[model samples]
Target: MKIFRMKNCLLGSAFLLLLLLQFSCKSTYELGRKRAHGISDNRLYNQIVDSSLSYKSLWVKRFSAHYESNGKSQNVKGSIKILKDSIIMVQINAPTGILEVARIYITPDSVKIIDRLKKEYLTSDFFFLSEKLNMNVDFYTLQSILTNSIFQLRDLYERQRPFIRNFKGKAIGDKYVFLSDKAAKVERKLRKDKYSRLYRFNYQRFEIDPSLMKITDVIVREFGEEREMVLKYRDFVKLEEQKFPSELVFKVKDSIQSLSCKLKYNKLEIDEDLKFPFKVSNKFKRIYPD
Candidate 1:
């Protein structure tokens, strides 16, 4: 009888422990969600946002790049030239040392890529890239991503008003963190009686060192039905009192395959009068989606 009573007491204690664990998990999650709710300093948040957006270079910016993607890697040089809200030109050099392999020109309304290896060219509107990446891809978005600058829903060149009014912020230890407002989630019926929901994640999130007003990392992600793209920035360098990433890693996953690219900059030049040259031969073939 004593053994039986002891077994019952042990079972009861185990059940009580499980309840406490569940309660503790719930409390942690709730506290995390409420962490940013107490943020009332609008000025500090705005300063953080502006610090990223204000990185528009006055003249031209160029960098030598090492790019790798799709199980295949290459050592190539690249350059970026942005004329503010007007135009952005990206050029990639071939490993042969003298040949230019690819060049891309992005304007407000169109995107053009010239490939010398394939002897082909691509021309499309922003919708082509937007659909390819499963997210909104535009001129400003590309420029901001390439330059490691802050981005918004609309291009900074296109809008006159501010679009960062809804950032959530909090102070954790010594760092100030900010995240974009959560996008609307989509729901769909998977099986006959079951439904599933997917959330639209942030286009980008910025973590800044408040004292220096410098961004430490930027994370960008977008999720679709079965595909997603993630890009992370790290290893920042101080350039003329501004911060820029020396390394960038990008990944994309889909039902069919996954692709990734790592870019490491070897040389960074500012205010240089750079050249944008792109020419496609008529003998080259153009590639299109099947």
Candidate 2:
């Protein structure tokens, strides 16, 4: 009888151990899935595109910068003063902090970059930069990149206001479809096809956080083999009930040269009165690089 009781105790202990092991494994798997995918449902997925593009504010932003090109590298400091839709002023400083090395002022119509070290300035339209790098870039594109907003016009534009271009949006994994005016027409005609007509969209895939619907990464390759750019945002922070990126890393690759940039935000101020101090002295010569 004692032996029988002993055997039953052993069997119960083994069963309990097996149950614990199964529970532990299940918990670990759940945690990992939550971490990777965040809270998501069909509705959340559908709404993410609109939520990501809705962030709007004006203020000054600053970060420590690390940049590299080919093999050369440099540590620098930078700040941006944004007046939404009107202007964006950028200042880049060398590590020494004694003198500002570069100042860029971008308006809807033009871009002006002043090199303090070289005592020269380059003033040109968006086409100049686009042609020089063989990339499709304009004021809004750069603004969206800096602000962690959607790059595609369909998501970026507000529903109440008239859209600059006709865009049709749909969700795809971590990205959203941004069909252009021409592409939207193509999509309507090709809807009957079994294969996805997603190829007709104007914008490429842009990755975003599932929960917050904030832009987390973007890779621009539409311009083809001549140029490509990759941007990744990490270390997010919540400010003013909005998600702000604490770290941004970007790489721009072109036939002539490649540039890599990493930005670590030390300070961020939103909806504050900001000042933009930008002017090129008469002593500075104007230099144009095409």
Candidate 3:
């Protein structure tokens, strides 16, 4: 009788422990969802847009880059700019004693890029340029780049909840072996199932500050690539009622590049009358260069 009672007690304890774990997991999942929903709310996106447009004028640190494709090497030099959306003009002096003048015009429908030195014009819709540059060419990147507030957590992830069904990590020397949901179907779709792509996807593994919600480190692994890219942020400062990063570093395999920008603010005004014309320039013939 005592043996049977002991067995029942052991089974009861095991059952209780399982129930507690299940409840804990459910609670964590709900909390994560709530946090994600809060971040995705339109209020956050609007706030970001509002803060971006508040600055009337700022100085942009322009870099003229020369890349040697075969050698995988790049050389960059600095220039200064006074930007007003109405007349987007920039003067860049390269190390080779070449002064290039460029002008940009942004509208709701199109963007125009003109090179005064080459007398070349490139015009396209925002989406085209964004894809060509492999960047988010929206107000977000522009605002962060201009203000040197590029490293905020809010800026990086936009407060979206990660859809991680199962994640495992193993300590490997100084680094960690990260494995998440490996199912291709689950990985290919966007967070909210808004967009789908063929690119191999994996959950980024890194530590972030809970309070600031800022990403401290990020790792991206493509399905076929043997290595991953890692980005680290440092040296933060407050600029124009916002916090931003002064330095950004990107590393992939054997190549590493660091960009350090100094934010300069000046008393300039924006021409709210700026409009985007739905037209393409002839010089961009090479873009669709026949």
Candidate 4:
């Protein structure tokens, strides 16, 4: 009879252990969701936007990166000097240790890119360096990098408002997911638009960490046909009263190409001696007469 009672006690102990494990897993998942949801709401978005716009000057190191299918990689290390409403100069170092200079002249009427490497330049009414890198970058991205401010999530949603018939957002585990009512419709419209080529690529998932207010992961789908890319941020620190990503990693489709960048900021002075060579050259007459 004592042996029988011992066996029963063991069985009960095992059952209790199983139950505890299940509860632990559920609690962990719930905590991740809660943390993610806390940051995705509208209030955090406004703080990010406000922080981005207050900076008038910036000086930082930027690493521009790219990948190819053959497992080859390219990195451009550079420093950027920004003078509000006037000029921006980017001095980049090629992988071959050659210096390539790009001067951007920003004005109300036009924007110009002067490439010193090839001695050629491009002009447009509204152009940003993100285009050169073939990345999905926009004004908000620029604002965030320049000012060390978090991106305003609301602004991103607002821009997509016209096409977003229905918006559903939720926190799943450690990730925050956003779904549009007419995702299919929006995809179709994007295909017909001039920017269709850019959106042709597919991503496995889109996620953001609400606590940091930063994009955490983007998994690429259909990688080779349309190269997939992911950007991860780390080592965030406050510089000049702003928080910025000190390390950035980019992973291409199939993991064929990978690039890691480390950023450093120094000698930050606002409204100092700055020059926008591109804008100045715009006023010069074409040396080679057409």
Error of 3 at 102 (Å): 4.2
Question: Which pairs clash in model 2?
Answer: none
**TM-score of every prediction relative to native:** 0.65, 0.65, 0.41, 0.51
Better of 1 and 4 by TM-score: 1
- 72 Cα displacement, candidate 3 (Å): 4.4
TM-score of 3: 0.41
| lDDT measured at residue 237 in model 2 versus the true structure, 0 to 100 | 59
Residue 126's C-alpha lDDT in candidate 2? 68
lDDT of each: 0.48, 0.52, 0.34, 0.40
**Model 4 bad stretches (over 4 Å):** 1-34, 37-40, 47-53, 61-70, 83-88, 94-111, 125-131, 135-168, 174-229, 251-273, 279-290
Candidate 2 residue lDDT tens string, 143-224: 6666666655333223423332343444555443334345444445447662244332333445545456666666554332
Q: What lDDT score is found at residue 208 in candidate 2?
A: 49
Candidate 4: which pairs clash? 166-181, 204-219
Q: Give per-candidate clash totals.
A: 0, 0, 4, 2
**Model 2, residue 85: what's the lDDT?**
71
Sorted on lDDT, best first, the list reads: 2, 1, 4, 3
The clash tally of candidate 1 reads 0
Model 1 spans with C-alpha error above 4 angstroms: 1-41, 53-72, 132-134, 153-162, 183-195, 199-204, 220-227, 279-290
